[model samples]
Target: MDIEFLKTSILEFVQNHKSYAPFVLGLMTFAESLAFVSLLLPTMTILIAVGFVLAAADIPFWQAWAGAVCGAFLGNWLSYEIGQRYKKTAYELWPLSRNPKLIARGEAFFQRFGPWAVFLGRFFGPIRAVIALIAGIFLMPQVLFQAANLASASVWAFIILAPGAGLAHYVLW
Candidate 1:
């Protein structure tokens, strides 16, 4: 039940299973970025912590970082596709349906920022999860959506992992 305990357990798991760090980190980032799933998982904090664990465990930072980037890009891509396919009905899906305000905010943000919303949203916690959905709903071009998604996801992964990695390196060295 304790969040810290869960984080510690995950860190321990990653530490013990260094070979799986990239895959696990990828999954974590995927869940963290995915629409609806992002709301429930709240894995960002744990992910940063895993960065520290990965460094301390000497699990190859580049591998973990790359995995995170790939997972994040794929997650957002799926969300965008879902939005495109489902349109407004995506909001009718359980958790999203329950929180209409999130959909509204995502829509407003997409309207206000346009394609840039996808790039900027990656940095913002609340809007990050839904912006892709909004982009899908509004039918943003695939090329534009992917450009921002890839760039932002890479940067976001670095931002999340670097600090912890740096701290671990500093302490370990």
Candidate 2:
């Protein structure tokens, strides 16, 4: 019921299960970036908190960062695949069907920026949810989509994780 409590619990768990830092952080970012899942779970805040937890737990930053990267890449890739498979009806999906503005914004962003939307969208919440899906629906080149996906995933993971990782040293220590 209490979101803060849930977040704190997760951070605590990550601190205690130092070995699972990568897995937990990976899963959190995966859910944070996934299409439908992203709409449901706001894991970004928890994810940032996790960075501090991992730092405090003494888990290697690269290991946890790699996990976050892989998770984000796979999550967006799955969404892109879904869009490719159901390009005609991606909008007909439940939550998306219920939310028209989200689609419109994604469409406009995709149209304006084209392939770069895939990369730029990662930093924006609304666009991030549907930009990759739109890219697939419009049949953007696979290589380009993947290139942006991987790069953005890597950068986005770093941006989200780095703050906590860096700040933990000064604040926690």
TM-score of each: 0.90, 0.90
Error of 1 at 67 (Å): 0.4
lDDT of candidate 1 over 1-173, digit per residue (tens)? 99878767866776788888788788988888899899887888888876778887778889999999989999999999999999999888988889888888888888999999999998888788899988998999999999999999999999999989989878656
Candidate 1 residues lying further than 4 Å off, grouped into runs, are 1-16
- Clashes found in each candidate (C-alpha, N, C closer than 3 A): 0, 0
- Residue 34 lDDT (model 2): 83
lDDT of 1: 0.88
Error of 2 at 17 (Å): 2.3
Give the CA lDDT, 0 to 100, for residue 83 in model 2: 87
lDDT of each: 0.88, 0.87
Give candidate 2's root-mean-square deviation (CA, Å).
Answer: 3.4
Report the number of the highest-lDDT candidate: 1
